[model samples]
Target: MKKILKACLLHSTAVSVSLLSFSFGVRAQTPQTPADEISPPVTDLLFGIERMMGSDSTLVETALEGFEEKYGDAVRGGDHIQGIAMTAGGQIVLSYSRQDPSKENCSGMLIYSSPFDPASPNRELDWDFYCETSNTDINNPPTGLGPEAHPSSLQASGNILAVGTHGGTRFYYLGPNGIEALHPNTAVLTGGRDSTGLTYNPVDRRFYLLNSDGSTAVGKNTIRLCRSDQDISLRQANQAIFTDSDCINIRDVYVSGQGANLIVQEDGTLFLVSTFSTRDLPDNLLGFADDNTDAIWGAYGTRCALETALLPGYGFRASFEDHIYISELDFSNRTADLVMKRDIRRTQAVQTCVDKRPAFRFAGGVATIRNGALLGLWSGRQNPPLLSLNDSYEFAFQDLPQPIKSASVSEEKAYLFRENNTYYRYTDSQGVDPGYPASTSRNWDFDVEGDDKEILGAVRYDNGHVYLFLEDGYYSRLEKDGSTSPGYPVKITDNNWPGLAPYAERIRAVINWGNGNIYFFLENRGPFGGTLLGDGEYVRYNIAKNRIDLGPRSIEGPWGILGDYDTDITAAVNWWNGKAYFFLEGGEYIRWDIDTDETAGPIRTSKYWPGVSDDEDITAAFRHQR
Candidate 1:
């Protein structure tokens, strides 16, 4: 009697069992059993054995032969599989690209009935989803192919399969019947370009597209998210609608690299892999190996096939050309390590010479199977093969470094100031960080010693100079090169400013107009607490002349001219529009024109700034020009 092996296949959607049971001698034939009958641990052990012996071993080979004989050859003699996806019900879907690009009926899809069972017979069905001849005219009734009609990427969720094309021109979805154009008559997503990558985010139940938009000229390519639950067919046409409100803008997250592929880990963390250039990696969320060269070859027009996969117990694995780089990510520390590397050429004969070099062309597609095994497809091979790696490798991570407390940007660089009075400048061109002045002394100028006074506030001027406000009415100036200006750390009273003599000790906030003047908000704690000084004083410094001009005046608000014991000024910021905004302790804000000294509003801050929480305190705010 043959030994019957029962196993369960756990997937994102539904669970199923393998019909072809493994046996030493004759293959054991059994009806499919419910997955619940087998415990998870036992199923895992069985799957582990299967993985060790390899999916294409004699057992699977016999099963494949039987399947072809029963169901017809679903592999289609090894057609080029452009995209692979698994449904929630344990069904596998493969999108095949046009073997002959010039032929109209070359692109189609194959639906496999038994997803996790390698022994399962041919695909359940195969259909032509892409008709290039009919799609040649994009504006016609039949819905012809646009410039981006060549499907290059695909993602599946539930019962829908989303197909993306090159040039980011068109998007389509394949349902049970056939393929249908998404937002068919709508102009909602017409503006984006280069739709090379697609993924379904289970956490938010939305579809994300990695592509570039109209702002690509300025390196603003980004990840765009579409609502998954929408009735896409009913969406209106000619509506230039797009969602960037929650979309991840590459410019904001990464300082330099343009995004190529995006992956959302099981834990909801999103990782974007870079392509083509040697741009600096992001310091948050995503991590990478330092040894991996940044010389990925894809650009807008050039199609460089790069792919990544999330390992079950390991971190992430990415493939480019003939090399595969595996990384271990420590999300807690926001770091990644390139733990291992492998050359695909050594395992398989994958070379088709285009020039003098072995053409690995279009060989970076990878997917994970239900049994925690990795499946990869290369341009040289039509069928996806299992990629084996050490499952017991360990990874270590370093603690994430704390970022600077505050930052201000200028035209050429961004200055990040820490609480320790040390500052670092990052050049925009190269994203390189140049450390602060010698650590031995606080002052960059050897002539003067830097003060240890905690920084109260800081502001940058248009001339590239920064002014630092400190405790006890002392201030310092830092030039663009991170060096102190001559005669630094001067006392506010000694700067020849008038009207601050009485309230200089109680200064609360400072604002730099960025032109040539700086303003100060001061509170007066007069003699005997409730005594006769004013509510507060507003002082101005003429930076060019190194003197105070029109200040030491009583702060006036809509409530009335502020009296000595009135509400105090809590926060203030220069809006960079020749106006300064001040917040009061009572939650109201008033705007003052720096040049005219005229005041407006005692209105609620929330009234002017939409989306701001009412309970949020206005601590600090600044604006930067793109």
Candidate 2:
């Protein structure tokens, strides 16, 4: 029912989010693995030759042969390898699922030993699949139960693992001890179905979730959060939920400057940048006049800002902190906070540099990691935008041999991770994308991964590597130094992973909890199910142990994912002080204490703003600095 539909919209006399043309690729299907069959390793590799260089292919081939020799029998016997995670200690956990009839949304989990040492006591530990046996009815399933039990994302703080399951449920796995349900078994709070994206930032100790779905009568989306130490299940019946609805449909979410600021990309209109705190996630909405005199065009991928140095003459500087810089298709624009500060001619050079990318392809998104440094990616025909700011900022677009679908910005370099395609890394002292370079030690190809495609969700950059999750059901890791292994693609199904794949259609959501855990969402399309893997599946990739833990089945049907199909879930997680936070697609959000691994109370948000209708959508989330 949910077509590859981009919302069709038109703005009023003022500016609005335009439905820019999206380059659509055919969704080709690979040979399906029967319930008892295992997918060929070679079948999982190869999309572009760029990824098959020298030892990379050999590494993957060797790993595949080893897996087949020792584990191939078990895989063929039936094991659903879903998602992965890497821990701070370097333990990698691989999750697998198996089907069961005890519950409608049944699933399971298997913990792999540490990748650092398989002989270590932490080898693959097969645990009983945690099914959705909670006694809750669908029409009135308990708070966190229902067909939407697909565990969307997982976060670990201290020794506790906080599982943000489908249908707005928070399942807490207290490490060696056991599991505890954090939220109440009621539908009043978690907007019925599974909300989309969820993330937890370690530094901030708060969780963030984006709210989608048509529950609220008013249009526009809502963003919510929960603290790390409080018990989400003990909240009152009608407590005032903490949320910021000032922005419309939030498409993508990002937290950077180490929680000093938050950014949300709403459709193709505004890149809302704001500051986050324990109290509120407010965004300063600068009112635009009816006249077109002071209006700026909404660039789909870039953000716009005015130079702070030029704001003193205008009263706008008081309302604004530093000058804001937003990106445009042809050029970048800067507006002062106050009308008096509007000396556009003085800051014209800055604007010119912003638009000077060597390539003119559609700049899809921009991310700032350490400080003012940023990396920009293009959608398809567009070019990558690179900008480095010192005393005088510089902007340039480089032409890559291949088009980059999505990218993540890191401290010293920019990682261009693609889906169904090869991967590349570009380095510029100026922090700009160096159009596909001819020769740079910084080049590694991931095209060897099965049917390389532009990755849908945002790529995640953490520690020293970039994790590329493509739509072809494969996830690969590439080091910033330009080292990549052939796609060690893993498969997911009910037989292998019981709990998380009930609705197995949509498995694109991913978030990296800085401590080494990788959280992801999967779709569960009820008994009848949707497109084979269309239902959401919640997955985790343990980088430390090289194993997976898959379960916490969804009881409700599909409709539980957050972010646009291609939006990165990592952007939603915010780390502040000693906590981590994230928001779901349906407006339900939670937080975790990095120090305690405890969940604070759940935070609910109103579905619609005053002027918005239930039919509208959430485009993005950003912070309005205090």
Clashes of each: 9, 180
Cα lDDT, model 2, residue 425: 39
Candidate 1 TM-score, true structure as reference: 0.31
Which residue pairs show collisions in model 1?
13-88, 14-88, 67-121, 135-144, 135-145, 276-296, 534-564, 535-563, 535-564
List, residue by residue over 336-380, the lDDT tens digit for candidate 1.
Answer: 444433333311112112111111232223333332222232222
Angstrom error of the Cα, residue 621, model 2: value is 46
Off by over 4 Å in 2: 1-128, 135-139, 143-150, 153-166, 177-192, 195-626
Candidate 2 lDDT, 348-390, residue by residue in tens: 2222222221111111212221111122211111111232211
CA lDDT, every prediction?
0.36, 0.28
Worst 10 residues of 1 by lDDT: 391-400
Off by over 4 Å in 1: 1-134, 137-149, 169-171, 185-195, 212-248, 251-262, 273-321, 324-360, 368-626
